[model samples]
Target: MLKKIDRAAAFIQKESELFRCPMCHQQLTAKEKSLVCSNGHRFDLSKKGTPYFLKHQVQTDYNQAMFQHRRKLIMNGMYQPLIDVLTPYCEGERILDVGCGEGSFLSQLATSAQLKPSVGFDISKEGIYLASDYGENLFWCVADLTNLPFQMGSFTRVLNIFSPSNYQEFKRVLVPGGKVIKVVPGSEYLKELRQAFYPEDETKQHYSNEAVIDKFQETFTKITRKTLKYTFDIPENCRLSLLEMSPLEWGVSPENKAQVQKNPLKQITIDLEILIGEFL
Candidate 1:
């Protein structure tokens, strides 16, 4: 709707200072329906109310339906324990969530406190479009992770939940002493589904967070890690979403997927590591 485009215009104009031109790295000014950088690189707010910033079309398996299912799974309180862990860091902070598909995580964080500046962006336009459906306090955009569009030293906290990370880009947008809070999966994350789909494949059954954890440790100067484990009883309505939500499903055979869907796991494990670091 045209109204959605205008709804976020005021927020963009107010927080225009946080943005940098993705192409030229110049300061950007928010116009009526677009963001124009000094060198004249303009990204319009069309298709979705959010500004479109990615230079190239991103073709990925995380399509609109996947994002919809993912969002439903999140909002169903599957991530409430994870949310409880993330709430303390978000109090009164200007936060940026990279790979913030469908905006569920940031929206939940925003509900915990009043965050004047909250922005969530993903490479997929579909995800951003779905994101706009959640809340108005946050700004949604289609942005590339490798080249974030925010200025250096802009946010107090940057959130990356179950998404890819680019430490350099995150560091570039955060001020000195700002924290990076990331969520990495534990080995048993979704073990039930993994066992159902890929029981024989050792690698497929267990998530390997070794490389990612090592990278997170190496990228920040000071960091804290917390591992939280919980299990949620899947409601009947969301059973299919559980089956369709994860990218891990992409590898399963059609027959296996159908069979499993008919008898999907009633409970799911939420094993995750929360990393918080600052002073990089």
Candidate 2:
């Protein structure tokens, strides 16, 4: 197998235009183990094959083990529907997955689009490190959503899945007719998980994407919206994974946790809306 750095460097070299110095906003050149810009700003590449593009370290609740379980659930095809719906909307040779955790969604979408030199970045170092496992054809990095480390008008398709949105930065990095495909949770998204944990909390039992969609509409004059709702049966093996994978787990009571562990949920909701629009 190729060393991690070996695989990542190859793609970085091929898709250098997707990157710029986050600190200096200058053109970046790929090197053996680092990226250097014309203005002398350098970002060291992790030995794991991903680059550190954040101006400073960021502390996030998303941990390595959580990402591992998340990837486990994802690999089991929990998010395949989202990927299927995203395929036809994807355009251009390259794509960017914003806030990509463990890189599973981007990896799957890249395959669907036959995208070359796909890029995925998140503020979580642990997430980015784990994402390096998919680095053979895709480049991964540690970056912020508010200040992406890429050149303006470099990408034709940008993906923001169940993650924060920074429309200003999104527009800066996308081509004139580029698209931003964002996925936000629907009211029933993960209802079972919520009922199991916070049974009486009405707020926890549901969600609303109105404000998020409203903001998206405010940014783009025109857009397409579609809701894909389904329930995924939890394989016996993935029951524990389901418990550990969600941020929802953070608020569960210890008693509730044990109860769910004793009687694993049969299925969980995957209701989400996909919002697609142009850079304008």
Candidate 3:
């Protein structure tokens, strides 16, 4: 088996031209165990097989335990409906998944769609650490969305799934006519969980996509929106794992958590809207 550093070095050597120095915007080249740029900015690949791209350390509420359950849920086909909708548009030479937590969606998409040179990055190091254990062919990195460490027009398809959007950076790194497959939570997404946690909070009972869609319109042309709504029957034993996977439950009271654990949900809604955007 190739050592972790060896695998990382190979990936960097193959795709180094696609990356840029976040500090100086210069092309990066793979050196001994590091990606270095003309400006002397160097990024070292971690022992876990992910490169550090963020300028500063960021603390996140997302932890390994949470991501582990997320991987299980995704692998078991919780988001299969969404994947089906996204498969057709996944055609491209290079694909990028922004804010790819644990790389579950991107890894599945790459494998199912038979895509090569698939790359995924997240601001959370914990998430990227888990993601590095995914396919060896895919490149995983801990990177900030606002300041992507890539060259202009680098990707043919950019995926933004239930993650924050950085339109400017996205557009900068997308080829002309490249597609941005953005997934946003629909109004009914996780309604059961919301109701369980915030039963009396009227505002928390519903969601709105109008604002998010409107913002997309401002930056992208030929925008198309598709709604994917489904109900996933939760196995009695997996209900707790589902609850733990969601960041929404992070701030809930311990009593509320126990309540959800006790009265397991039979089915959970997976309502989402996928927006396909092309640059003008």
Candidate 4:
């Protein structure tokens, strides 16, 4: 009763072209209250408020805690500037978000613009599952990027922010005239944390430079580059979640954690370099 209606609503909301099957990369047609593919594959939308794009199984390295912190930080506007730089490329057409953790950026893009349709894919099931609350217009999938489960030339714009990029797969799925927006850390990203954790006065801690990104740009047109930086005060309540979301998780010693807990950071730097390129 209620389950059927929820599925129906989800199906109708995903009426756009983003709900293609992850395995077959076929546009799904909602038939008899279930989503079906041309080759006879089918997946029923879950009443738990998520669309089951993968029927079988997919493994992921992410856990609920990682996304939980990321969600809060993003929603708090930690990465707003990066999203602003990438939004212009959308222009009301198809867009694909690779490794879209918790779908915060995608959700903001959908609400802020008159977007045509957008789909978000991640290797993390928990990430996608948590993303369902954003909107029905946004299609969420749990899948891998090394071998993207999408058809060729499916998207007009692709966005990869602070995530692993599969260049070959990204170029394959994007339309010939499409563009890609990638965000990486600037030379000063998280300098404060690194200083506190490592205390290595000899080693210069910094971010990726143009030379480091040269291999990435060989296949695309280098459009523009911009650096963004801001200071954020870490509240005592959310400090633990913030620590878990960082690479410092492994590098931090038990003693270091104790230090952080005792003298929690008042402010930290969020520095990033945004690169916008056109597919060649």
Looking at model 2, report the run of 10 residues with the lowest lDDT sum: 87-96
Model 3 C-alpha RMSD to native: 1.3
lDDT of 4 by residue, 99-138 (tens): 8888898888886666766778787778887877666456
lDDT of each: 0.86, 0.86, 0.87, 0.71
What does candidate 1 score in Cα RMSD to the true structure? Answer: 1.5
Per-residue CA lDDT of candidate 2, range 1-280, in tens?
8888888877777778778888878899987677899888888777888888777778999999999999999999888988888888873357888999999998887778788667899999998898888854788889888878899988888899989988889899988888888899998988888899998788888778899998898787569999999999887888888999979999889999999999988799999988988845
How many angstroms is residue 165 displaced in model 4 relative to the true structure, after the best TM-score fit? 1.4
- Evaluate candidate 4 by giving its C-alpha RMSD to the native, one decimal: 3.3
TM-score of model 3 vs. true structure:
0.96
For residues 1-280, write the lDDT of model 1, one tens digit per residue.
3367777887778888988999999999999878898799998887457888888887877888989888888898999888888888788899998889889889988997667678999888888899988656788998999999999988999999889988888888988889999998899999999988886788788658889998888888779999999999998889889987878899988887888888878899988999999745
**Candidate 2 ranges with C-alpha deviation above 4 Å:** none
Q: Which 10 successive residues of model 1 have the least lDDT summed?
A: 1-10
**Reference-based lDDT, residue 135, model 3:** 64
C-alpha TM-score for every candidate: 0.96, 0.96, 0.96, 0.83
Cα RMSD to native, each candidate? Answer: 1.5, 1.3, 1.3, 3.3
